[model samples]
Target: MKGNVNSPLHSDYLNNKMKSVQRRHSELKHATPHKLRHTRATLAKQAGTSIEAISEALTHSDTITTKTYVNASNVIPMAVGEIAYRNLKK
Candidate 1:
C-alpha cells in the first residue's frame, strides 16, 4: 500500500536506493536505472523475445524504436557457415 501519494518513489529515489544497495559491490559501480533497463532489454532479445513484444513491454510507440533498443548477440556466422557447407556439398 502506498502510504503517501505525494511521496511516491521517483527516479531520483530509485537511483539513490540502487546506489545504496550496490555500494559494497564494486562490479555494480555504474548500475543506474537506464543501464538496467537496457540490460533487461538486451537479455530479453537474447532470450528470443519478439521485437513487437519487447516494444509493447517497453511501451514504445514504434517497433523500429524497439529494434534500436535491443542488443542481442546471435550466431549469424555459424548459420552462414552451415549454409555454405550445404551448398558446397551439393
Candidate 2:
C-alpha cells in the first residue's frame, strides 16, 4: 500500500518487512531503520560533512540532538586519527 510521510508504516511493520527481506535473501541480520540513520550520520561526519548540515538533513529540532547521534563510537577517533596523520605529514 502507498503511504505518505505522515502515514508512514508503523515501526513493527517496518521491522517485519525488513525481516522478510532478510529471510528472502538468506541474510542473518538487517540493520534497523534507527541503526541505519545512525550509520548515515556517522558516515556523513567522517566524510567531512558539517554537523549543521547533518542535523538539518536528519531534521533534528536541536543541534544537541544531532550531536548525540554523532557519537564517539562512530566519528571522533577516526577524525582525530586523520588529523594526527595529516600533522605527521607536515
Q: All candidates' TM-scores? A: 0.65, 0.60
Residue 47 local lDDT, model 1: 49
Runs in model 2 with CA error above 4 Å? 1-13, 24-30, 76-90
32-57: candidate 1 lDDT, tens digit per residue = 88777677777666645667888887
Best model number under lDDT? 2
Q: Evaluate all candidate structures by whole-model CA lDDT and list the values in order.
A: 0.71, 0.78
Q: By TM-score, who's the top model here?
A: 1
Quote the positional error of residue 67 for candidate 1 in Å: 1.4
Model 2 clash pairs are: none
Q: Model 1 Cα displacement at 6 (Å)?
A: 18
Q: Give me the overall lDDT of model 1.
A: 0.71
Residue 51 in candidate 2, Cα distance off native in Å: 0.5
Residue 28 lDDT, candidate 1, scale 0-100: 59
RMSD in Å for model 2: 7.0
Tell how far residue 15 is off in model 1, in angstroms.
0.4
Error of 1 at 29 (Å): 3.9
